[model samples]
Target: MNNITKEITPLTQNDCFTIFSRVKKEFNFPLHFHEEYELNLILNAKGAKRIVGDNVEEIEDMELVLVGPNLSHVWLTHNCKSEEIREVTIQWHKDFLDEKMLKRNQLSFIRRMFDRSTKGILFPRETAQLVYKRLLVIDQMQGFDSVLELMSILHQLSTAKSMRVLSDATFNNDQVLNYHSRRIDKAFEYMNANFHKPVALKDLAKLVNMTEVSFSRFIKRRTGTTFIDSLNEIRLGHATRMLIETTHSIAEVSFNCGFNNISNFNRFFKKKKNCTPKEFRENFSGTRVFI
Candidate 1:
């Protein structure tokens, strides 16, 4: 798997957010996370793999996504053969919209949108196309006009009807709770450490000092997913990273991700990702290895 690392993206002194529009021949960034919120737009890069926290998928000709602070993400030039790849990236501090600012009635939707973005959010094609056009001209504005345009862009995104949340439940557990529940925190800590093994629901229930039924209901209420589904999501998260970063065979990857049988692994992967493991791996170009 690629060595997931933290990156520090530099920002300018006077700007609340920094924006960049670049035309590059290749996407060579490693799998990394940063402290700032990011809105990225990519054009003319089809069949590229987009890795956001525990989620992995292929992008089409144009893609737009909002990634929250410290969420690992990267776009690799998988099958794209474009001579010039157009990309626009906007980065802002996590506190750019403070709690007080978000509490305002007018910003309620944007606040909720930002919260959901703790697990990366992908805008649909129509919204993407609309924002893509706006982004193309944003660099031309200056001072207050620039800030206004950016706010307009965010408002448009906040109202979009069909955005997809990319990462799985495990990836958002910590962010969603914000250390509010110690028991849930401990449960996640244990799960992260032992997900590669056959973790029993009874064992987990006991660890949290509850019966199996009560524990199941508690977890479902907290995470909006069943215990088994959450465990599989954690395993699949690791499996996807392995598939992208390692040369291991599907069987080996499955076993390493705690699946004892290949058939069961294949079934679970297809159900979650809508594609077979082999096809997912093949979506990326053979030449690009981001480690």
Candidate 2:
């Protein structure tokens, strides 16, 4: 959790990685990552973005980006002129294919594709358009033919020249794997429990009995973000859920999420999400609830 892989295992042992996803709304999720190789083709999107390991950017359609396992990222909508609809996102596990294909065979070029993933991958416009078209065709196929088409896609991805990695730090080491994880875990637990409502930095620092500055640095070193940022993440996380699944008004959501006024909530949401509250809600529903 906290965007890191605890262990490195053989590729063949891992499965259950989803190969594709489709969404019909503007996405409202936080910066979280899983232990899989994700190849996403965003057919439609308009938002602000945060790619934790390397960048914080603005993302729009049609985007083709590849996210490596455990790389923390988020693309929040600050404002949507209309509804947000995403077409296809293809995410494959690092071990989804064969071991020999990745470890020993240059015939597959899978390892090279993974190397490119270190920086995150973004396919150029025309290429993504082509990939999406082919993916649509493959979606209608079944059985072995489906697998063959997917493998063909991966093979093309392996040889693709229109790719770029999205982050700076390739290694996302799990805190649980660290010697100091117990302390880190306790601190994180406490932060999660009380991030909303008024959170005092000094009090949070004292929970682990450290000075504010020292604690802040300690947290940043462990999670690639400061303790305050972690707290805000909690609040923002809740806000995202409400925006997507509930019918709360923006001011109400703001107050419930621990922010004071409409302006502050707007500012914070925009900074973190890259889109206004109304836009986020519209991405999911036309329900006119508060953002």
Candidate 3:
């Protein structure tokens, strides 16, 4: 990650949300994060690279994603050559939805969806097609009615099927680590705390009171990734932050993140970020967008 910018969104403290719609020739925003939650819709941008946390993918012609507060993301022009691109962005404060309101029976589904958005959520094509028109018109309406309409859109999206989580579960430190199991929580807590040191599956299994083999299976089932992969993700997350906030040498960053060797660290970092650590730092040092 380059010195990823932190965007101060236009939503005032008193506003429920803000929407921006545009027809543009290209995507130019820098990789950035914000304190507000964002729902962004883009059309005619196939081949554009979408980066959300540690996940990066070439977007389709039509795409929609919900990015949680402070999660790094950006859409780059890449191979997208479309002269007419349509984009709609909606941003809201973190406290826009009351905690108690989200817990209600009518809003439980939205609550769970919001929780998953911490990693960024990619709506399927069908859902994106269904919601894009609504998003486009949302800014035109005013007052309390517009807020209700936005809620309606979220409700529809919440119930939509097959929305995929786009980033690693442990990529964001502030993300709630809830696996609904005490053992899983404990294991992750330990991993996050000691990710900068040598850690092994056997040690983690013992800490969670399980045999090595059983612990491996349990973690795989709970997080959909093996123990080693999960640990690597944690290390990579910290490494990204360090890259942005520190002037340490690339070798230092690699070693301090617990990678035993520079080669292995470079391999993993490139695989996750699509660029070398040095390239990432240089990119961030050049230009940035405050939007």
Candidate 4:
């Protein structure tokens, strides 16, 4: 991504956060990312296309999502026919809450939610409805009260049920690695670095000084996926970047990303993104405007 725009938001040093409320006919903003965590609520925008990292989906009438800092995201008008689309966006700097404060017992749920936001968290419609009232008037509050209100909103969202993560976990490069096991961490570190080449589970097991069957069980228990699937996820992450950043052919990108052939690449890409590589690239075309 060279084409993905980097948005320099209006949030200043003196502000805890910035809120933008607007009613528009359609979405026209380009795909972009910024150095601020964002909570966006959209109403009456059914059929609109939402792209968060490598995840693309059609939105419902009411939508709420929390996107982490520097994650590429955008909403396109697409098939939406609504003449009035209501949107409320709240953005805060990453450091707005101290790391120490986030670790406190009272803030445990919020802290976990923040960590999951790196992949973009999609709040359910029920939660969205419950909190939309507060979000609408939060900008009207003053000083410390406003800060407290924002924190309250986040805490509520953190405990909501059925919150889905929109993007692939590996799509964000800044995600922290904390499998909480030394062997698991080492295995993943090796997998990430060597994703462009052919990988074998036997080799990884040996590298981690464990037998193949034992290593497989350990990795699955810790990471919740098989070794081959994890390797493919890493390869797909790099492939998505190449698809967005380069003009290379699909077969070339597949090979360069360590997939043996185009069909396998297409299968994995569609399995993860619900679209072929070509379509994924085209989604980023035409309407992207940078300034």
Q: Point out where model 2 deviates above 4 Å.
A: 1-20, 47-52, 104-108, 171-173, 176-291
Q: lDDT tens digits, residues 163-274, model 1? A: 9899884243232333246777677667767867989999889999999999998888776668887677767767876787699999999999888899998998876665
Better of 2 and 3 by lDDT: 3
TM-score of every model? 0.58, 0.52, 0.60, 0.60
Model 4 lDDT tens row, 166-242? 98853543322235688886887788778779899998999999999999998887766789987887788678767
lDDT of all the models against the reference? 0.78, 0.62, 0.81, 0.82
Task: Please give the lDDT score for candidate 3.
Answer: 0.81
The better candidate by lDDT, 1 or 2, is 1
Candidate 2 Cα deviation (angstroms), residue 30: 1.8
- Candidate 3: 10-residue stretch with minimal lDDT: 282-291
Alpha carbon lDDT at 34, candidate 1: 62
Local accuracy of candidate 3 as per-residue lDDT tens digits, 180-252: 6889879877877887799999999999889999999988877666899878877886786677668999999
lDDT of 2 at 57: 76
Q: Which residue pairs in candidate 4 have backbone atoms (N, alpha carbon, C) closer than 3 angstroms, thus clashing?
A: none
Best by lDDT: 4
Residue pairs with colliding backbones in model 1 are 78-285
